[model samples]
Target: MLRKALLTGCTGFVGHPLLARLSNCDFSVVACSRVAMPALPASATNVLVSGIDGLTDWQVALAGVEVVIHSAARVHVMNDQSSDPLAEFRKVNVEGTLNLARQAAEAGVRRFIFISSIKVNGEGTPLGSPYRADAQPQPADPYGVSKMEAEQGLRALAAETGMEVVIIRPTLVYGPGVKANFLSMMRWLHKGVPLPFGAIHNQRSLVALDNLVDLIVTCIDHPAAANQTFLVSDGEDLSTTELLRRMATALGKPARLLPVPSWLLEAGASILGKKALSQRLCGSLQVDISKTRELLGWTPPLSVDAALRKTAAHFLEHRTH
Candidate 1:
């Protein structure tokens, strides 16, 4: 008796690895993606990409799909100056999420796995303590707000239709194929670029990409995970200085850091309106994932150090020569 699963966002950073690992499990997976992702090999059941918005009828993909992992989201930096920020976030993060979840529930899908962000807890710098799943959502940006709304909307649909909703909020995920800050940091460390992050003592919780995917798979089968909200991380917190040094070690480069007054740095960034960057580097964002571990007996498979090293190796191998 093979368990059949439907995975959305199969093209995402977490989704690709997840599908690969699931190949060896008892489950046969059918992946759903808005864009064309790399195809799984013949040893695996293979992934199929479908445009959710283009489907005239949901029954094609929804039928007999036991588990639904919703991993797609509109994740972009604030003040990117890129495009219509709100509209772009809403199209995928809100409406896109509901469309799939509704169809899945209607088709008798058992569990809806939502890959939400820690931003739904608090956008930018968290003031003091970590933002737990219990905290009222105070999403500041379009992306964060959209995720929070989607969570509530999914929960409501679950209540109405007796479907199970598993909402997972992972903070600052980093691993192979990682782009943005994590990748930029790797590049800077490899080149020995001086950084101003050493002085900050703020503790931020980060999730290894593999660890997050493991959590997702564990949740898929764990009875306690259904109809629950979990905040997940590496369970180990790191300061900006410590993380930079570790990244440097992974890149086999010296830690390039210059100690500076925190207030002065904030003042300059505020003036230049690089406020978002400043907040990210110095923010005190931490989550206590004991609930996730205690409930499902889950432990991060990859330690922070190993995860960073793997990510760095991947970047260095294919780095622009």
Candidate 2:
């Protein structure tokens, strides 16, 4: 039987590829977005819902939708200028999400899959002690707090309405068409710019876009995923130095790394008001996906090296033009 799935944020970084993947998987997808989307697959039916908020109506799009993939949320921003960032995030990530899930439950939607963030687990973990799937949530930012609240609301709703909810918290996701820090790193590597991260030994677990999408697809119908939360990654943690070296390898560039002491870097960043940026580059944040694998029997299809190569290739192709 072909499942009818409703996908929110169809134009987002994760949702765009997810829409295509669902369509390719023969799912009759209702691609919901705030604006009209072009180049959708034949299996996808586009529906416009202007902005996700408490009042946004999902009735039309939720019709006959057995599975709902809610990837739309107020994502984290580096320098948020909003006066009340927490309230801003709560309006969309928490209220908007609950509103959609409630309506989906009312519409008889069987399963709802939410794409959350690893920030819900806290900023960083100890070097050897990675966060587990069942770890207590210690959201460090407004975005993370909102997602945590949304998860709590969804759980409560699930118990009340019997609509299954699957929550997936993924670490920094990167692949083709990646932007922000990952793209910047690639750009710096492409230019053979010498970096001073040779001595920074912090492990971070990242998931490839394809791998994350694959996990979401698996959760759509997997019986074990019902009412469960999973943390996802490539399952291979890499230090700052190792990651740059691997990226350099993929880019076919020499890893010109200077062994600058991490203390000096942190001190410099603190003086320059870049402490957060420096922490991100030199902090250890790892998640243990053993539960995700044990329960769903899923493994990342794309290796980190392969994903980096693809990212590098796309960067080179786009940079040249």
TM-score winner:
2
lDDT score, candidate 1, position 176: 90
lDDT of each: 0.82, 0.93
Q: Which residue pairs show backbone clashes in model 2? A: none
Query: What lDDT tens digits, residue by residue, belong to model 1 across residues 71-90?
Result: 87768764578577877677
TM-score of each: 0.92, 0.98
Stretches of candidate 1 above 4 Å error?
35-38, 43-56, 77-84, 124-128
Per-residue CA lDDT of model 2 for 22-98, tens digit only, reads 99897999999888888889888999988899999999999899999999988877689989999999999999999
The 10-residue segment with the lowest total lDDT in model 1: 47-56
Best by lDDT, which number? 2
Q: Could you give me the TM-score of model 2 versus the true structure?
A: 0.98
